[model samples]
Target: MAILKHVAGKSADYGAALDYLKYEHDEVLKKPLLDANGNWVLRRDILLDGINCEPELFDVECEMLNAQYHKNQNYDEIKTHHYLISFDPADKDECGLTGERAQAIGMEYVKTNFPGHQALVCTHMDGHNGSGNIHVHIVINSLRKLDVPQKSFMERPIDCKAGYKHHLTKDYLKHLQQSLMNICMRENLNQVDLLSPSVNKITQQEYYARQRGQINLDKLNAELIAEGFTPMRTKFQTEKDKLRDSITAAAKRAKSFEEFSRQLQAESGISVKDHRGRFSYLLPNREKYISARTLGTSFDRNHLLMLFESNALTAEREKQQWSVADPIAVLYIKSNLRLVVNLQDCVKAQQSRAYAQKVKISNLQQMANTIVYIQQHGYDSYDELKKARDELSAKMSDARNTAKSTDADLKRLNEQIHYLGQYLSTKATYKEFLQANNKKIYRSEHQEEIAKYEEAAQFLKRSSPDGTIPTMKDLRAEKEKLLSTRAVQYESYAYFKDYYHELQTACQNVDMILDTGHTQQHSRTHPKRSHEPSL
Candidate 1:
């Protein structure tokens, strides 16, 4: 936020100019007051003869004032004034005002803070986006006699460059800032520290970067290294080749070290080890090559190890348990889930837009109907009816544009949904690898048995008339069917076959218990027994 102030007008027309200035910008028009003539007056001055107003430049003052204020007003009766005042838009809200709201607020401030005198506080927007900034043009009526002695303008020549000397001063600006700060505090808005000038100046990019969590971890590591410490890398790769590939991939992704480390662990099972032997995983074994420093930036093995060690200690203190689940599998599932959710949200937003557009079209149609009815009934003159028809047509055009925008939004949403669905299907194949690595059963020994049980369950679920519980007869039939359909091998499949039946029975029992009032505790303690004779 920045502030710029200017003053224009002689004492006689200062009141009118101030009044007109109030109408210039939306924010300043709302200010409470514009004068410093009363008891609450912060400061005032009447330079009179000492105040130099070049008669030749008086026209310039009128022109400037008219350009900002009276251009749209009845100019014949409006008197122009030359008053000096400093202005800044950033402090608009601090004065308990903003946009159109500031106009009233500014007027009140002038009346209460500087009574008897008149002034105008105007506000404006600047930059690419319309960020409102307000500056006040406090024009005091010079004709109004002041109880205080006028300043000797001869002793101190009027500095036209310094607008403050003509009327407002540096102290006045400080007072205004203080007043605005108080208002801000009362309103629970952010208040700039007047003691620190730097607090008032921040670029838009800096503000946005801070909001988006754009951290400079490299700088942090450098500072630490300067203190005789090395930053560690906790991410691991499957092999030296994989590690090299990850480094290359990370550079291509342009991801931060932390983000890359997380991505690697999600894509690959290999975890990086630190000096203390703590570990974090890296991405998969890809053929890509990346630079070492670029991959982990300022992080090295030692620093990573230290971090891992610290985390391990914390986990130990908390009695945290590690899962056998592959980090990559979990990451894949989570990433896919996020994609799905994002796509869903986008779809919903598009639907909402479509609904809004439909409503707008309906409203426009109603307006058109009303206009048609008026024309048919001869309720209005031809010109009036024509105007009404034209307005309705314009509304219809706007509605069409809105519909087109909604269509585009819907198309984008559908594309995202399709992409997410495809990604999910591709990732589903990886579930087999995940189950093989983490499940209690060995795929080599139990894959066929598990598949049989899954098939039987699906068949029962689909074929059962009333979805009744599987009976002993049903289980025996399923077992017999499996034994007869499959060719006998040298190794007996009976053990695994029996185990699969037991698991299915247990699942059915659990489901039955869950339907009843029996708790999971009881179900866990009462697993189904195998009907087969003991080996």
Candidate 2:
């Protein structure tokens, strides 16, 4: 997955932007991480170069352009725009990604998307955090030196004109992100949903702050411990972190905006408000409110409403279930779904010595539900209950496996169909290149299209074991049939999954109650048995 990030530079000295890229920085101290030679240190697999300017004179060229364009002359104006494209660390081992290849992709990316700009493109193997992710840094001078041809994504007339600063509009940023995703897909590299909002969008500043905060907290904890004082907190949480936790916990059980707000206040004193369809959280004793976007996507209005809708549906389902039967106590199994419990034949399990340790006030509710479940299902013995659970589990597994297999096949067919289209689109270009007298020169002229055609052809050949390629029409027909099959398979899977969960919970609750009750009975009958050992 290639994650894209942008940071604008306001310093008038263009050299500062270049320095940060070329050198290493101690992130915590905001100073250069240097070597004995007094030069900035960096990873060994570093690839660096400048585009549309002399490598050494990149700053001079930018200064000359700025003077000529008479733009970005203000003291606090953005002098440069830095775009970072960080690829998945796993790609190095799984997909054989290297700094050199990543650099090439970065070059192609900048050339195609950011034309007519003096840009510096560089790649790093083990950046700041030393995560081993191959990331590219592309920093461009704010002023456009050459007029570019109008493109579909360009929004304004001055966008294509010289002397205009590079515009980082939301649309433009999205375009860049999509381009990265496309590149990842074409290259067979792991990719993420780059277009969607991040759930927890922690910036570099916040990330470092958390690290420093934790270190400070640990130090304070050690000092307090040495003085025979118990520290109140073992973990440190930033305000944003606290807010995220409070909002998520409140949202988990909240079914509406009003309920969510009340829960937030009652649980954590964080009052949430709706301002023009956006949710903002006001932390206790804080003057300013933090917007939902700053916290992450899951807290946004749309996501929260979707969560509430799901919660409402669950509530209705539970209501209907109870209306048809007794008040079934909720038996949480990871997911907080309400479940009816009853699998009462656990006499054999009650003999275990560990039962006494597990009993609590909650066991009473569980025991009642277990008895009701057994009576409703007519499970006469522990054997009968076990048999039912095992049978349902088998059915659930079969349906789940079938659905998963169908889904995988659909993905394969979709990728093949896309590859087939690519091959067809560029077949003419490949043919023309083959027939040309000067093969090398023609290949050079249409390198991109030819490369794409070959890549698609190879993939198609590998996919088709029988060497029989299906036409697009046939592929589409097959895909449709598979889609229909998948729908049916998923329906069965869903039904079995729900049934199995309820039955499984009933079995567990029954066993728990029997152990607790039987252990207590044995204790009353023979009080000294626990302390008395067999001779």
Candidate 3:
């Protein structure tokens, strides 16, 4: 899951933002790490770029812009707004989210959302806490450097103009979160509903506290080991950690708000309170209640209500299911709600002669039900019949269009896989030739391999300009998935086509029946339908 966070800097020093992006900061000391040479140490790996300003001269440019616009003079003014996009670590393996690809995506996001700002777009392969989650840090000067076109995320008219400072709004943040979700989906990366609160939100202070406490505990255990004494506990849990665990365990089992509160109090000695439609918990020793925001969104009032409702529904469904089945036998879940045991249960559907001539149904009874069905669907009138036919035709067209798109995707993927296989097959000799003492002689000796490799290389370059090559495993899996999807599309297309033809045939039969009924009304050979299907 990708998470977005915004932090505003209050410092007047414009250079510090760029410095932070370039250097590794020690969270324990709250300062940048310095080498023996008395200079800030560069981070392990990063992809840094500038937006509307030179990255190396970012501080100078921001200062000059501030002087020009007469902004950020006050000590309390926010100098920069830092936005972080942290991606799920699993994305590296699942979605092939390399640092280069993530950085490119970050750059595109910055260009589209923060075009007018002097920004630093930086990506780190290893996250701040060494979680190995690829993340991007975008630090932009609070002041806008150029006029930008109005966007959906923009709130006020002044938001478009140059020299105006950036302002964060609820609407803007929601838009950013939604937009990030879209990008993740487009790239086939892992993502979540970021607009909703996190299930477990550990603030920076809590995270660091846990880290420090664990380190101290490990040291204490080491001393005990040296003294040849057993250490009872190896793990350290903060108060909030204990609170979160207790709440989570209780919330999962409790079916209602009252039950959840009672369980929490009984098991953990934590009192749960619902105040003004929000939920909070008071730890045993704590004087104040910890707000749901601190614990996570899962413990909030709305989410709790939803969870309770789900539990109720599940219990109801199980009870009804058990009532209808043998207690010792496990029953299959329902796909269709209606269960029919006899024809009489479906009167109109059972086929009773009133509809025989109305359509080319199997029997007189079926014919009777066919006309009943037509009347029930409001297709007895000419206009309604014509409308149904038109709608079915449109649906048939849609099926065809969708199938075409799926086919095109499958074709392109197959082509790319073929090119990839060829490239991999001839890669060894080509690489050896490149690294040879005399490359010209090596290339001549391996002419066939070089030629084949070059042909494959050219095709692959055109296919993926970003040098994105899916692993053979990934490609094979994708091919299997697309094949299954193609089969489903084929089935859908066939179903729609058959339905379209059947409807057309029924309409023709109905027209013929109407003409005969009009011509023979005076003959007294047949009586009108006594009962019609209730609409």
RMSD of each: 35.2, 26.4, 24.2
Tens digits of lDDT, candidate 3, 1-535: 8889888888877788888888889765558998999988998789999999999989899889999989998889998998999999999998899999988988989888887999989998867677889999999999999998998788898888999999888888888899899999999999888887778888877877887898899998896567443464578889988888888887786789898888777667789889898888899898988998887887788888888778878988987887576321222222211111222244454464354223223434444544765675556686677676677688678878988898998898888889888879998898787679998899889999889888877776666645444556456656665876788888767766766665565565566556546646744765545573331
lDDT of 1 by residue, 1-535 (tens): 3222233333334334433332222222323343455322221211111112332233345445444433413434324323222223445445544444544444555544443232334433231124434433444332222222333321233322222122455665566556655654664544555533431233333344433332355565565467433443222222443455643454343324464465455444334433343333343344343323333422344444445566556666544333233211111111100001121224444567675555545544544444444454354554544443454345445555555555554454444334334433433333453457656555455565455444544444444455432444234434433433332320123323333333233333333334433534665887646862221
Q: How badly does each model clash, as a count of residue pairs?
A: 59, 3, 3
| lDDT score, candidate 3, position 422 | 86
Model 3 misplaced stretches (Cα beyond 4 Å): 27-30, 34-39, 224-229, 252-256, 302-535
The sequence of per-residue lDDT tens digits that candidate 2 reaches over residues 1-535 is 8899888888788887677776787766667787998877854667888888866678899999999978878988999988999999899999999888999999999988988899999898875477878899999998888988999888998888888988889999999999999999999999999898898988877877987898899998896567444564677888899889878877788888898898777657778888899988898889899899987898899999999989989999987786566322222233332332222333433454354224333466566767766776678988788787788788788889999999999999999999999988997998788779999999999999999998987788778865444568557757866987899999877777776787778777666666767877987987665655321
Worst lDDT 10-window in candidate 1: 331-340
Worst 10 residues of 2 by lDDT: 327-336
Clashing residue pairs found in predicted model 3: 355-367, 355-368, 356-367
Off by over 4 Å in 1: 1-100, 123-138, 141-167, 198-535
Q: Cα deviation of 365 in candidate 2 (Å)?
A: 38
The TM-score between candidate 2 and the true structure equals: 0.58
Question: Considering lDDT, where higher is better, how would the candidates rank from best to worst?
Answer: 2, 3, 1
Ranking by TM-score: 2, 3, 1
Whole-model alpha-carbon lDDT for candidate 1 = 0.39
Clashes of 1: 59
